[model samples]
Target chain A: MERPPHFICIQLPANPEYVLIVRLAVSGLANRLDFPYEEIEDIKLAVSEACNSIIAGSPPGSLILVECDSDGKTFEILVKTQSVDENDGALVPGSEQDMGLHIIRALMDDMEYLAKPGSGAVIRIRKNMSA
Target chain B: MDIKVDKRKVEEGLGIVDILGEIDVYTSSWVKEAIAEFIKEGNYNIIINLEGVRYIDSTGLGVLIGALKRVKEHEGSISLICTNPQIKKIFNITGLSKIFAIYKSEEEALAAHKEG
Candidate 1:
């Protein structure tokens, strides 16, 4: 039998003022997993960038949903936007000069962009604990 | 987030802006406005002290880049004082370490500016 991953979810208004709260929650979760300080910083930065991008591209009054899961070996976060159009600019991939996307690619072990029908965009980022 | 501009350097066409707190999307505009004010006042030689800053996002980085461009228009420069390794790593990863003058201490940055 395998142990199931523990999941944590947070839903907040799509506002920049709440970004710090998200970072604090994610940092606390990562700290509980015994992640190193430097790795924790990287995870926080990646998550912040994802949230900022979503807030920038989404319409006003949107909601952001953050999902985190870990099994002690790896941590993953899904930053999703709600009340956004399917064709919103937030869902579109950024160009080479997009520093936020670039930082996410450099810091995270893996990343994916999901554009679900009527659910806005999802930026999924993962980090391996031992890596 | 808060910014303090050094008044003593104003006469020398230099602006020393010390920033404290996280420089993310919400607070980056403050930095942009501070630098823009410096440029508008003809103080193009700017020194941004990030010693009090523990975190900075891409929007903050973009503001710094924009300030650099604005200063360059007048043949001025922007020097940064950053002691945090994580923040330094972000500059390295973005390849901004090559284009910007980053010093570990304010003394070192001021000395280099004087030498230049």
Candidate 2:
């Protein structure tokens, strides 16, 4: 049997103003995990981009769910969108919004996007501890 | 996460806008507006001093790029004074280091602007 991963989740209004707070929180958490200063900055930027992506795609008054977990060797985060309109899926490749996803991909070790029409989209990113 | 823009005239028709704070999705528009307003005021030659910026995301980068494009449209030039290693890293990551004329100090950027 696998042990449960240590996780922390935060829910905030889908407003761009709250992205700075999320960046600071993730910075602190990454520091405690012994990530170097540069790596912490990487995490901060990646997480901020992920949150902003949700804010741009979803409608106003939506909520963003951020879940971060660590399993000793790697860190995983999921920025799940809530109540996103199905028709606003214009974050196609090469567009301006897609640049955020590309930045996240460059900063993190691995990433995957799960889009759920009429509901929400989930962006999952993983970073190895030793990388 | 408050952003403060300090605008000062550096030379004839030149201004230096020093942005102090994290530039993200929330605050980037403010930076963009400040630059746009400067362009509107006929200060075509501008240099953005980013020595005090602690963080910047893709939106922030986009704002700078947009400002550059606008200045170019007016036959003006824009240089960047960015000393922070992290900010430089982001610029390099986005291939903006090659696109913009980046210098280590404000004086250097001003000299470069004067040369051209």
Candidate 3:
């Protein structure tokens, strides 16, 4: 049987200038979890990309929320932004502006983007312990 | 959170930028601006020394790509001196290793420039 995951959450203004704080916090948390240095770097890059995506897709002054959950063998992260409906379809490729999402997809083990319609879009990413 | 770009003329048409600090969304714009300023001054061949950069995100990668494009537009080149294994892995994962010239040290990159 699997154990319940421990979760940590953070909220910040949807400002591009503050994304570094999120990266720093997650780096420390992942290090505590004993993630390899390389994996920790990937985690930081993935989360930073998610925050950048949210800030680009959302309206100004909206609050950004980031949540991290960890079980013994896996780690999960969710980023919620008050922004456009990502449910329409995958964004156009090679647009330059949306490259952040593609980079996140490449770095994280698994990724999903859900749009909450009027509320915002949520980007969820997961990484296994073995990674 | 803070990024500093120190520029020095290596030769008549070459310049070096020493980047000190993390490069993320908060600081990538500053990097872009510094590179743009270098290009505006007709420093076409640019070498970015990333030895002091502790962290870089996708936004930071994009900024570098933008700088490369700007240099290429002027028929110039951008070489990277990055020794950190983590940063090198990111470049490999993103396939940026194929896009830019990467060297293990600034001296090696400078030598390669002379050879080319």
Candidate 4:
């Protein structure tokens, strides 16, 4: 049997206030990886943008899952929201009302989107650590 | 996102409006209102001291940029005194540094306002 990788996961209510705590945590993690201050700030903005996206998409009483893992050279961030109306199409960023994902895509190195059951979506990013 | 605005009587025909708080999307309206109120009251010479403000989102930047445009057209100018490096970077990155005269200290901003 293969062992799962070590990671930090947080399940929390969909709220804007939680972004600040996430910023602080990402800062610490990025600093531990010797990321430059500029990179750290980018990480903070990336996370905030992701959380804001989830808060905007999720319905009431839904959960936001945030996961982070370090593979000795790069950091991966995965944010999943278990709230979506599959009947509706994917949300568009900068379409008169959505700017969150636009900002996230600008800050992160790599981004992946997965549409899931129950109107859910998972976004994953690989944040490159400074060499 | 609380706001505290203080008006200081500077030299002849000039006043300073010092604003403190988080000027995010929600509180940015308050900032715009405060500036508009001052402009309407003919207290256009303004210097926003953001040393106490630790955070500012894009909406806040928009408010500042909007006010600068409106006030400049009326022969009035604005500057921001931001000591926080993080907030200063946001201002610079968002190009408010070039649009508005930025000073490191309130006194510097006030002196520049008087000289200009």
Candidate 5:
């Protein structure tokens, strides 16, 4: 049987404080899932790093959408920001100049980048909950 | 997130700090300050309680390592009470769990301190 989807989207303000908001939400969700304290923290940091990536863009917009899904065993976090398919060197993920890329990679099980169908940049973070 | 630091008298003059909060980039300074403040006060027996903190990052790990360095310079002591596996992984990844004494609980850390 296919798993039920557990998803939620948070409209974040383009600000650093929003990082804290994402942290709090992820922490709470992790807690509800009975995630180990340390794993919960890991999730929290992953979410924060993702949000920070968007925050670095400092795009002139409100609401950086964060979609989350959990299957009681793994958690998938997606942060969609205002951007189209423009690899502006400054925003490239694997560049030596970007700190967020390294942090996100180190903290999560898997990280994927996708340009929105119409517009924007979306980063997805997936992690195993029981691992 | 909230961080409250505690200071207590120790037989060997070890400094201890109670860390309460998510230890991410946004809040790691709170831990850094606790250790820095202790070092400045000339105390080195440090035992950080992670029973309260659920999240930690490399920045957070780096800060802990920094504190450990400061304590080592003065021949001081630093330990950790990590109840969460996630925080434990960070320490393990950074090889800090080997350098710093990590206990299962605050009581165990304090007991080990007494034996040392």
Candidate 6:
């Protein structure tokens, strides 16, 4: 039998000021998981980039939800935001948003993107302890 | 959460911008504005000292890229001094290491500036 994953979640206004809070929270969680210093930095950067993309693409007053879970061997992060304007959340090629996505992809072991019919954009990233 | 950007002249035409603290979405604007001010004052060759920076995100990297473009228009260049392994890793992973000149110390960056 597998043990249950540890979970942590944060919800904040889609404001840039709150990004630090999210980063700190994720850092603390990763530290508790005993992630190496380098991997912890990578996780922090990936999460920050996700938040930046969501905040930039979402509509005003939008809220960002970040969820993290770890099972000692694997760590996962999910960032979600709701947007009324689909086009507003679309990633423009060669834009900063595109670059941000590239950075996240390079740092994380795996990354997936989803656009729910009415829920908006979601970015899921994962890291393996041994990777 | 907070950042401090200080600008000083290295020579008649060269200046250095020293940044301390974290550079994220919220604090990157301050860095951008400080670099813009340096360009406005006709200083082109600039060295950005990031030794004191503990964290920088893609937004912070974007600010550096933008500043590089603005300075390049004046035939100026932007060199970076970063010693932190984590910060250096970000530049390498993003392939920005190839685009910008990075040095481990201010002295080396200054020598390179003088050589040009």
Q: What are the per-residue Cα lDDT tens digits for candidate 3 across B17-113?
A: 9999999888988998998999899999999999999988877899899989988998999999998988887788788999999998989999999
Clashing pairs in 6: none
Instruction: Return the top candidate by TM-score.
Output: 2
lDDT of each: 0.83, 0.83, 0.84, 0.69, 0.71, 0.85
Assign candidate 2 its CAPRI class.
Answer: medium
Candidate 3 positional error at B47, Å: 0.7
What's model 4's lDDT at A17?
Answer: 60
What are the per-residue Cα lDDT tens digits for candidate 5 across B1-116? 45565665564567567777666666777778867987787777878777877566666777888988888888878888886876677676556778889999878998998898
**Model 4 chain A lDDT-worst window of ten:** A91-100
lDDT of 2 by residue, A1-131 (tens): 55454677788998998998889888888988889999999999999988987776565678998888898899988886755332446523223347788888888999877665445566778989984
The true-versus-predicted C-alpha distance at residue B16 of model 5, in Å, is 1.1
Q: Which residue pairs overlap in candidate 4's backbone?
A: A84-A119
DockQ of every candidate structure: 0.83, 0.74, 0.63, 0.25, 0.20, 0.78
Model 6 chain A worst lDDT run, 10 consecutive residues: A85-94
Model 3 fnat value: 0.74
User: What lDDT is obtained when candidate 6 is compared to the true structure?
Assistant: 0.85
TM-score of B-chain for each predicted structure, in order: 0.91, 0.95, 0.97, 0.89, 0.86, 0.97
For model 5, the stretches where C-alpha displacement exceeds 4 angstroms are: A1-7, A14-16, A26-42, A52-65, A69-76, A80-91, A95-107, A113-122, A127-131, B110-116
Query: B2-106, model 1: which lDDT tens digit per residue?
Result: 333332364478878888888988788877887798788898898889988889999999999999999999999998999899999999999999999999887
Interface RMSD, candidate 6? 0.9
Q: Which stretches of candidate 2 lie over 4 Å from their true place?
A: A1-5, A83-97
- Model 4 residue B13 CA deviation (Å) reads 6.7
Return the candidate ranking by TM-score, descending.
2, 6, 1, 3, 4, 5
Q: What is the TM-score of chain B in candidate 2?
A: 0.95
lDDT of 4 by residue, A1-131 (tens): 54335466777787666666666686787787778887787777667666666655566678888888888778888777845432346633223134445555666788765554435566677787656
